[model samples]
Target: MPIKYIPYTPNTIEGQAVLDNITRTKRVLRYRENNEVYNRLERGMPYYEVETVEQVGKPSDNLVIRGECLSACAYLKEQGIKVDLVYIDPPFASGADYAKKVYIRRNPKLAEKIKAAETEMDIEGIKAFEETMYGDIWQKEDFLNWMYENLQAIKSIMSENASIYMHLDWHIGHYVKILMDEVFGENNFVNEIIWAYRSGGASKKASIARKHDCIYFYCNNPDTFEINTIKERQYLDKKFIGTLVDENGRFYVDTILTDTLMGVIHRVLDDGSIKNYSCRPVLNVSKERLDYSTQKPEGLVDLLLEIASNKDMVVADFFGGSGVTAKVANELGRKFIHCDIGINSIQTVRDRLVAEKANFTVKEVKDGVNLFRNPQQTMDKLSTLITGLQTKVEGVSNFWLGAINDSKLGSVPVYVPELIDSQQKLLDIPTINRIINQEIQNLSITAKKVIVYYIDIDDEKELKKFIKENNATTTDIELRDLKNLLHETVVNDELEFSVSKEKEEYSISIDKFISDRLKQKINEFNDKGNLQAINKGKKFDPINISEEGLELIELISLDCKNSEGEWFSSTEIKIDKLGYVIYDGEKSKDFWNGKITSKEKPLRIKVRNISGDESIVSVE
Candidate 1:
């Protein structure tokens, strides 16, 4: 699929003026309360330690959550769960869509020439397909309000001596630092660490190349907080020239290098136990790479953890992209909590921690965003379900999705609650009051009607009566049930298999597995424009699916339970990027071909595709 790469930067000089004015005044970040983001905590449903499952990890009380961290923090604060350290890399309000590269699994049934060529091409560009994981697009003022709420919620659950690190790039780091100062207190502001990397695009001669990301660190209480001055040999570069070896026959020297990371390039020791690490991006050839988009290097997290926290202290990462924080925390003997808003992130982290034998429990919040698919797909489907709902409109405020034009009524502004955002979805008194007091005043003066869409309403009769009693806008107000407008067909992948009884064991034979989503992605890939393929400077041979859809299977597991309530992996096999199998969480190459035999009775089987879509099949 062709990716629409949109570069994000400040559009007008007015934005610079606004920022400069804020800097000239008091050191604080201010923004419009666009959607009443702080009210989301009231409607948030908390979920905690629902159940434990059998997985490949050691026993510990660590957690991996698949929901919004703000809600999770609310629950943690109520339960008195205090975190000593936090390192989050939240979205930087960039108007860009991020995608993950999907690879086609190698097939033994295919010809040797095709398999060899495919394996060679896997080193770099031109993978099988790609799918959007999430979009980091947001309005400038609205993003600040959202970040402010998150900071307040996170501060409530931090321990007395806790510390936090907020990672950001050139987009909005300066503004977020001011917000951090307001929430954490200006006196508690500790340090701002600069991590220089070479991942972004080089400058085009018109401007200088921007490459570093700022990490704003703060303490809950500077008086009680004690940060360790972690020793590194690189800072001793000039000192090594005038010093000699100590009595232990060992000397430390900061060796200088000119390759990358200009400051304190390397280190050396007389005992040959040299330890050196550069603040860099995760390279493709690095062993710590999991191919997850926006994944940060482990060394980056290590340096922060070493300075801020100690062993056994609770460390939390709200924007846990790929679980690098949780994995490193567990490795460093610290308890951790990993939370995010994407299932793909949860799955990626789960598998990584499992492979490392790190103990953690999986969790999901009971927010209304719990849907059949992810939030991105659900949001995309809303456009088709709601007729004439415009997503973009000029001069019309974003407070409304867009003014839906009606033949009878000239223009009606539509208000739809975002499924991913829990704070603004429920149509309650706060939502209604905002519409009347805050939003209505900003909308186009010509708009005579306003429509509000909602999944659940708080006291609909009272709300309708409330709107009638406080009709200040003189606009025809209508409340529409969001679910009532849903009219879409659904299809599921068909899974067919067989189970035979052997000597005190059950042997499961995979007959056929079909995935609709994967097939659709392939079709979209082949439908690329001719000019786009020509830009490749080589012939683009289309991929044909002839293996009965076996190439789509990335994971297979049997939850051999008598009844299905909670999922448990009794026997499992996962195909890696190189076509190797991880049987029962054990990596193996050229194992028992396709047929998997288990000594226990198979109850149900779970299959996951290479695109991270999963489905379950019952054998009863």
Candidate 2:
């Protein structure tokens, strides 16, 4: 009996495994204000924004709403924004620095400590704290857990046929792969691409310095996504020895044969000599063939984009650290949404987009607006707004919703109102005429400042008549002599930097909170150790503190531990201007050598033995 190759189907028992691979979550953060969501939509109102904000009676698009990602995902689902592709490059537990001089917090308490350390260190306060607190200890598990929580939200928002590319490195690549298998179903697992790159720097002391990272590709269901193929640069094993041409206009080693115990014979072809053998179950082709890079190349992104099919497909990146996937989507004319908790990652995306001259519209506003606030209030306000306009306008544009019948805002999709075109005779009515006339007046007034688009015109006469009837007076309105104006559409990509600046204000506040907390913690440690008084005469060198160490302190209180992996009793050690160390008896010995001494250099104090030797060694 011959074995038949069966195509993988997502509907089968095996297929169900893929869909069931997603992780489940119980609780997600909810916001205190609905006004934030509302205000955000209003403030950043685009002339013709993307599908996310292009719903009926949406609030402001100007707000930067941060809440439970799961909740936001729920709203997106309600909006009918089903993602087709998701690429998450979330935290890999590499302790890679994130954001503006801060590392992601593994321990909430440690996060609190780093915040406390920020004040006394001044400009170097946060740095100082990280050096003291997290200098030695690296928390790999906490980072992974934090990342997984966010990924749960990402997974929930994807379509059944969607694909995900989770980028990782050696740091925690293997662990994440296991997690992906568990979440995305083992059968749904696709390829593990090793993205190789060449670096100028050589790895001298170590075994082959790593120059590549792992990108795991998985689908919600097996064989449900688009696969893009590329042409090989050249043919493999060109056995075109002696004018060997086939009907297909290609050359091949026409003689490759072998015989098996089943009485099957096979032939093999060599350049000048013939080779044949008899085997149990004979095989014919023995030539090794190569087409392109066995490993997926960097161009993999372009190929994936081509397979996506839909022009306005939703492409999400929850682990959007470098943002290559998003950038590729944008370049390929696909709409993308990306997010990362890391400030540096977000900044990287922003910079790359801008540098590529990718078109984007952004608006910023203050935080108090509460855009993604109470979901109920948003629904109520939207109801009132839509109701008030129902009798006033003719036909609501469905450009944003495409064919989706339902889309939610807050937790409810905008109620799609039945639309009817205003009758020609209705233009004669004063009340109806007044609204039309007002719109025309507003259009005429703003035409010079912005592009004026006219739609639904068969000829010049209709255009002129419509304009005259509505009292629209604008030099920019091209009186359509043809039917093309009927299909007129307009979009805008203007940036309001002021809105961005205002949005930055809230982030700055968050930053300050982190700063204040770090400083406070540092002060507490200093006071407990009685190092504050000694600081009066001591000159501190900035270089002694490592950037990573300070980050750890800011993230968590720099709780120092001893050589035995035990928390050391807290005490104060003071340094004089001449770099003299003073501690209460053995307390000073704990930091410096066994005795208090003066030195010109800043003492290197190791904390927790996370990195080098010593829990907290002071060097001068």
For each candidate, give its TM-score against the true structure.
0.81, 0.35
* Residue-level error in angstroms, candidate 2, position 143: 3.8
Worst 10 residues of 1 by lDDT: 1-10
* Model 1 lDDT per residue over 5-31, tens place: 111111211212133222221122112
- Candidate 1: misplaced stretches above 4 Å? 1-59, 111-127, 199-201, 235-241, 244-273, 387-397, 402-413, 433-451, 472-476, 481-492, 530-540, 591-593
Compute the lDDT of residue 301 as modeled in candidate 2.
50
Question: What's every prediction's RMSD, in angstroms?
Answer: 7.9, 26.4
Candidate 2 per-residue lDDT, tens place, 1-620, comes to: 00111111122223332322322221122222332221111011011111221111123221111222333344454445577887655545665332122222222234345445652212222222332211111355444444444455456667888888876778778777766675677788777766545432246895678666677888887776655532221122565446454456655444211110112222232343322222121112211111110112224454445544356676775545456666767776677665532223343454345445454422221111122112222222333333222212222222111111212311111112111110110112222222233433433122221112222222445544654665444422332111122112111111111101232221000111122333444555455445644667664433222223322221101122333222222222332111223342221211121121212222223221111111233222
Q: After superposition, how far is residue 76 of candidate 1 from its true place, in Å?
A: 1.7
Off by over 4 Å in 2: 1-72, 98-140, 200-206, 234-300, 307-310, 342-620
What lDDT would each prediction earn against the true structure? Answer: 0.69, 0.36
